[model samples]
Target: TDLNWPEEPIYKEYREAIKAKYQIDRLMKKRPNSRISIFAKIQAAEENLAQSQAGENNSDFDEEIPF
Candidate 1:
């Protein structure tokens, strides 16, 4: 339990390699991966969609060609 596992899956490879290199030959398969839930991902996507929609509707900026 002294190992500091990463919260992201991308870091899992590095973590596993490090564990293998330093661990006392213990299996890492039983270890749990920390990550965000699917609901969180969905909520973030929804928020992004709303922001994009709002930006599209509020396009009061100049459309002039800066050639």
Candidate 2:
């Protein structure tokens, strides 16, 4: 099916409100003192460390902005 699209941005507030509601729903579902396995914690830590190291390595390279 062919679709007609808006040339300018639209439904900005509706989109943001939907995102906010999703975040609120996610936060409400999270339990305090949730149990996580030690191995899972280690894996998460390793992933975070890897991401930070990757970012640090990329810091030497400059990124170009379209604007």
Candidate 3:
């Protein structure tokens, strides 16, 4: 069975949305004395970190399983 799958529209939409959100957050950070913007950037960074960690964990788990 082929494990490769084509990318779906929903996934593309999600990727685009994440990219746009991050860009907005990045621009917000450039504004001095913008506490609200800073907070938003921090939140976005934390969310990205959590997602990265989860992906790493899943990859490790996959490697541990005997095929």
Candidate 4:
């Protein structure tokens, strides 16, 4: 996984997301913003959202829940 990127769309999607996340995390360090931090804060938010929406909740970003 480190040396090669798979041809599947799932791999491509994850790769892009992780790349963007790292880029944003680096940016947040160089230019700190109180409004948002894309690292741990976002992860925490995602967890919270997941728990809160464990019911019949609808979202515009109807992404699949990871395994």
True lDDT of residue 33, candidate 1: 28
lDDT of 4 at 26: 75
TM-score of each: 0.36, 0.36, 0.41, 0.27
TM-score of 3: 0.41
**Cα-based lDDT for every prediction:** 0.67, 0.67, 0.75, 0.69
Question: Model 2, which residues run further than 4 Å from truth?
Answer: 1-36, 61-67
lDDT tens per residue, model 1, 1-67 = 5366557664667766776787834544334322345667888999999999899778955565465
lDDT of 4: 0.69
Question: Would you give me the overall lDDT of model 1?
Answer: 0.67
The list of candidate 1 runs beyond 4 A from truth reads 1-36, 60-67
Q: Pick the candidate with the highest lDDT.
A: 3
Tens digits of per-residue lDDT, candidate 3, 1-67, equal: 2235456544767656765867866776666668778889999999999999989977877778899
Off by over 4 Å in 3: 1-33, 61-67
State how far residue 5 of model 4 sits from its true place (Å).
Answer: 44
Superposed by TM-score, candidate 3 places the C-alpha of residue 15 at a distance from the truth, in angstroms, of: 50
Off by over 4 Å in 4: 1-37, 55-67
What is residue 44's positional error in candidate 1, in angstroms? 0.2
